[model samples]
Target: MDFNPPPYQGTNRILGGKSVTMQDVAEAAGVSISTVSRVLDERLPPSRSKAAERVRKVAQELGYRRDIMASSLRRGGTGTIGVLVPRLSDMVMALVYEAVFRAAERHGYFAIVATSGDDPAQEQSAAESLLDRRVDGLILATSRLDDQLPAQLRQRQIPHSLILRTDGVSRSALGNDEQGGYLATRHLIDLGHRDIGLLAGPNFTSSARDRQRGYRRAMNEAGIPVREEWVCESGYGIEAGESVGYSLLTRENRPSAVFAINDDLAIGVMAAAHRVGLQLGQELSLVGYNDIPLVARLPIPLTSVHVPFDHVAALAVELLLAPTEPSDPIRRVMPTLIPRASSTPPASS
Candidate 1:
């Protein structure tokens, strides 16, 4: 039996079979190996600008790739970050994770993500798996209000930060859900919508509770009674939203407007409206949270609260990389409202 590897492709393989190294680049550029290393690693002093430029050009032409694992080991770090989210199938989580991955690359760190299906037990298991892989830190976007994983991470002295959701006991980088809810409700109220229904998310998550509070506050400030029947707790998906929206919209005295806590729920509400023969922004004004890309491309552009996933991800990464004391405060990012064709004054029925 013979064992051999395949030939390298492109310019990466050079020097008659061996991969290009700093020594080859240094010799070609007429500079010492240390100078070549400094130039390639971008650690050269300002006095060596010409030499650095020459070395960089030579290295690029030779297709010299640095060994990231060796460099990380030299620095006593893994140069890898782990991310945990509910599931990538959720567009919101996928977009957030995309931002995390991009930000990690910008910081010269690799990011690996895993799904926990929003289950605390699954989250713990996934987190343990990430730790076993020797990740330098973690970014969690699967926290419930009563989750103990953040505490456990703290006990273990792991460098971690929470995104999208938080337990309020950990360093978190998340949008201001209460403010987003308030903004969504207030937009409806300002448009003369007195009766508003809410398709709130599950109560276990702080985001759901906070958004509900904001809705209540907005309605109360406008002197509009929040009908208990109009407020339905829903799962974070289109199916749950559709089921709840159908029940609410079919009622004899259904609210003229509905505010869904997420785009998925909003989409479900739209489906229910179609079934109920209600025209959005006319017979029934609707608003959604998380101004995902699909919302604007909808037949009727959705009014939504825009939570900047990139900003949240960047901040979460920064917090995870930062050396912070146990007493460091949690961080919150504010959201903005993006009005579109889906929200308007209630139609005269």
Candidate 2:
């Protein structure tokens, strides 16, 4: 029996074993280990042009793959960013996360996301887990006014930026919730809607409070009496909206229009309207915020406030990655009103 090894095919040989390291390339190229490191890492100055070229060639031939984890460790960074969101099931949060993920990739950084289910304790736990992974920074979409997570992060001097929500003490990227509310309410008032209900979000969130403030301001400016009973504060969800909508619509003297703080609530209100035998845009007008895609496809297209998810995500990432402190004083992005079939002048009695 002849004992001999088969000839090595380039592709097969390259795929057969462990990943090729910089040391292997350096030895093959007859260069110092440090020279290989500097060349492969793109840290070699222009002074070593020829040496870099040679190292590059050797690395390519040897199929050397740089260990990014090891390299980042040496540089005291993980080249990773952790994003915390309330929940991924919410279209708004999902879109924002997608934007952040793509934006991070464009800037040569990797992004990881963890959901907190909108629980403060869960958020803290998730944050600690991300920190354990040595993430260089964080982008938080779960900032609540009374939440101490942002304060803790500030105390630790951890690089972070708030997105969609704010604690007011740290840097944040947010939509102009008050302006959005005002726009929606003013549109209804202009259409002869003196009796308007508001489906506001929870009080703990600055967004909810700001939007409610805008609603009040608009109503007050128009000389319309804001019925205390017409304002309902609840969780940011369709079920919450449905419950509130049913309560308002079933009352003896229901408002002619409602401005929900988000599309989910508006959708729920629509459901209530259907159940109450009210014709949308005719008997009852409705407006929503966050103009999410689902609102457009409704049987009656929803009038909504458009929050710029992409813009907010990009700006938040930029703020998080800035080498120096962000100097831009104005951090809120303005929202626009989109009119659709869901809102119209109240039907004349």
Score each candidate by Cα lDDT: 0.87, 0.86
Superposed Cα deviation of residue 296, candidate 2 (Å): 0.6
lDDT of 1 by residue, 229-321 (tens): 999998999999999999999999999999999999999999999998999888999999999999999999999999999998988888887
lDDT of 1: 0.87
Residue pairs whose backbone atoms clash in candidate 2: none
Per-candidate TM-scores read 0.88, 0.81
- Candidate 1's TM-score reads 0.88
Worst window of 10 by summed lDDT in candidate 1: 3-12
RMSD (Cα, Å) of candidate 2?
8.7
The top-ranked prediction according to TM-score is 1
Query: On residues 235-293, what C-alpha lDDT tens digit does candidate 2 reach at each position?
Result: 99889889989999999999999999999999999999999999999999999999999
Error of 1 at 147 (Å): 0.7
lDDT of 1 at 32: 80
